[model samples]
Target: MEDRLLDKIAEPFNLQLPEYETLEAMIDGILPAVARFSEPNLLPEDSPLYVNSWVRMTDRPGATEVVMYRFQGYQQGEIRVVTDGEIGSKAYEVEESGDRIIVGESIMRDSFLYELSFIDDDFLILRRHGNLANIPHPYLFFCREAIGTRLTWNEALERLVDKYRNSQFPLLAVGLFVAAMIALLIYFR
Candidate 1:
C-alpha cells in the first residue's frame, strides 16, 4: 500500500520512486532557506509574471514553516504582504508528491505547485504544477535576484505579447487582417 501510494504521488510529476526519495532527502537537508522567483525574462516565456516574491522555508520539529513575500505592486507606495504558514504533510508528502502546498489562503493556495525541482545553496527551481497555472512551461525559476523587483502591469503584458511574436499565430492574424482590408478597398474602388 505504501508503494502504491508513492506511485500515485509520483505520477503527475513523472518521477520514479527512487527519484522522489532522492528529492525528499534533498528538500529535508536544505531547510531554512529563501527562494525568490527569478526575473521575468529569465524564466520560460509563458511562465506567470509576478511582481516579485520570495518563499522562505524553515524546518521545524515536525513541520516546516513556509513564509511567502509577494510584491502586489508599487502604486500604493510599496505594496507587499508577508504570509506566514506551516507546511502540512498529512494528505501527501509535499517533498515528493509535487502537490499544491496550501498556505491557508485560497487565493494563494493554487498559485504554484510548490514542488522543488532543483535546489542548492545559490538557487532552486519549483514546478508550478496546479490546475490554475496557465504557463506553457510548468517550471518556476527562483533565485536570489528575484527578491525585491516589482513588475508593472504594462511590462507583464508586453512580455506576454513578446512570447507569441516568435510563434505563427500573430503572423497569421496580421496576414488575414491585411487581406480583408485589401479586398474591401479594391471592391470599393
Candidate 2:
C-alpha cells in the first residue's frame, strides 16, 4: 500500500518509487526545515537588488569562502551557505537581544551583526560585512541576510549603501551595474 501511494506521488514527476523515497529521505533527514521553509519567499515584491558578502569558514587553512548575497525582496531573503562543495543546512538563531536584529553566539565574539535594513512595501535590503580588503580570500564569517521581504535589487543596494556608509565597498556601485548586466545577459541568452 505504501509503495502504491509512493508510486502515485512519483508518477507525475516521472520518478520511480525508490527515487521518490530517496528524495524524501534526503529532504527529511538532511535538509533543515528552516532553510526549506525560508526557500519559497526568498525575495519580496519591488525590493531593491544588492550584492552582499557571504562568508563561511573552510576546513582548509587560511581560506575564507566568499559568495554573492543577493537582496531580492520579491524572491526571498534566506541566506544559504555552501562549503567544501557541499551545501549545508541554513543557520538559525534564537533572539537574545530582544531586537529584530539577531546574531548567533558562535559569531558574537567577532562582532557579527545582521539587520533588516528596510521593510517598506517596495524596498528591502540586508547588509553584512564583505571580504577582507587586503586578503585575496580570507575566511568569511557571519555573513547572512534575514528571510522575508520584497524589494528590488537596485533599491536594496541603495539602502545598504545609505545605512552602512562606512562599510560600503568603494566600487560597489560600478560592480553592481556590471553584475546586473552580466545577469541579464545570462538570463536572457
Candidate 3:
C-alpha cells in the first residue's frame, strides 16, 4: 500500500508511539529518513528547504539494510523507486556514554553521531559531527521530515524548516523585529 493508505490505518488508531526512550529504540527499524537537509552549500539556518526522499530500511535478526530509495523531484507522485536487492544488511549497534549515544553499523561503517540539536517522535535529525557522508550534504548530517501524502513544491520547502527549527527561533525572530521597530521609532522621534 502507498503511504497514505498505510497512514490511514495507523492514524485512526491514534497510535502515537511512546516518547523516545533510548538510543537502541532509535535504531529498532522504526524511524526512516523521510526528509533530508537540502544540498546547497549553506548553513542549516540559511537552508531554503529540506528534500523529500522515501527511504525503505528493513531489519533482520542481526542486521539492517537500506533496501529501497527514491527522490522527490526525480519521481513525483506515486512510488517509483530504485530497489537494491544486493545492498545487504549490516550489523548495527547503539552505544551510550553519559548523554552521548553513538550509533551505526556494528563496525561503524556509514555511522553518525546522535544529533544534539533536536529529537522527537516526529523527527530524527543526525549530524556527522563535521565529518562528511559518502554523499556529503551541506549540513553534514541533516534534518528530516515526512508525511503520508505527496506535497506541493511550496509545502516541501516549509516542512523541513518547520521540523528542524528550534522552538525559540521563530519567537526570537519576531522579538527581534519588534525591538528593531521600536528602536527605529525612538530614533526618529
Candidate 4:
C-alpha cells in the first residue's frame, strides 16, 4: 500500500527510488543531506515560493528511529518574510515505515507524499505532493548552503512572532508596551 502511494507521488516527476536492500539504509543515506528549494518556481505564482528543509535523526521510543524535520518556506509578501527575512516553518516528526518515510502525528494530516528524487553529501532533491491537488510541483531541489547550522523550533516560532509584531504592526506593539509600562507605574503608585 505504501509502495503504491510512493509510486503515485513520484509519477509526476518521473523518478524512481534508488535501489537499497533495506529502508534503514535508504534513510541513513539521505538524512545527512540538507535538502533546500530556493529558486522561484512556476507553481504558486501568486506567492513568492521557496523551501528550506533538513532532517535530524533521533533515537526515540515507539519507533525504530525518529526524524525531526524542519521545512520553512516563504510565500512572497508573507508579512514576516518580507520585513525580517525570517519565514515560519512546518516541523515534522518522521519515521520509516516500509518503503515510505512516514511523517508522524501532527496538527497536519498524517498522509502526505514524500519521495527522494536525489540525495548526496551536499545536495538533496525531493518531491512533496499533498491532498491539495490544486498546487503543482511540490518538488524541491536544495543545496547545503541553505541549511542552518543549529536553528531550534522555539527560536523559529519566536523569530516569526517577533518579525510579524515589529514589521506588520510596529506601532501597535510599541503602544501596547508603553501602555503596560504606564499601568505598572500607576499600580506601584
Instruction: Estimate candidate 4's alpha-carbon lDDT, on a 0 to 1 scale.
Output: 0.36
- Model 1 weakest 10-residue run by lDDT: 88-97
Model 1 C-alpha lDDT per residue in residues 78-183, reported as the tens digit of each score? 2133444433221112322222332223333433335554433223355555653465444433332343133222232223233333452466665676578668
User: How close is every model to the real structure, measured as TM-score?
Assistant: 0.23, 0.22, 0.30, 0.27
**Relative to the unseen true structure, what is the C-alpha lDDT of residue 132 in candidate 1, on a scale of 0 to 100?**
31
TM-score of 3: 0.30
Task: Give the number of the best model, judged by TM-score.
Answer: 3
What do the candidate models score in CA lDDT, each in turn?
0.36, 0.34, 0.35, 0.36
Clash totals for all candidate models? 0, 31, 0, 2
Give candidate 4's error at residue 162 in angstroms: 41
lDDT of 2 by residue, 1-189 (tens): 547745664453352222222212322222232222121222423323324433321234444444333332222233444454465433233233312232332434433444342332222323233443643322122222331122322233333333343233456665676578668768988
What candidate 1 gets wrong by more than 4 Å, as runs, is: 1-110, 130-134, 145-189
Q: What TM-score does candidate 2 reach?
A: 0.22
Q: Over the full model, what C-alpha lDDT does candidate 3 score relative to the true structure?
A: 0.35
Model 3, runs deviating above 4 Å: 1-88, 98-105, 108-114, 131-135, 138-157, 163-189
**Model 1 Cα shift for residue 24 (angstroms):** 24
RMSD of 2: 20.6
- Model 4: which residue pairs collide? 36-142, 48-76
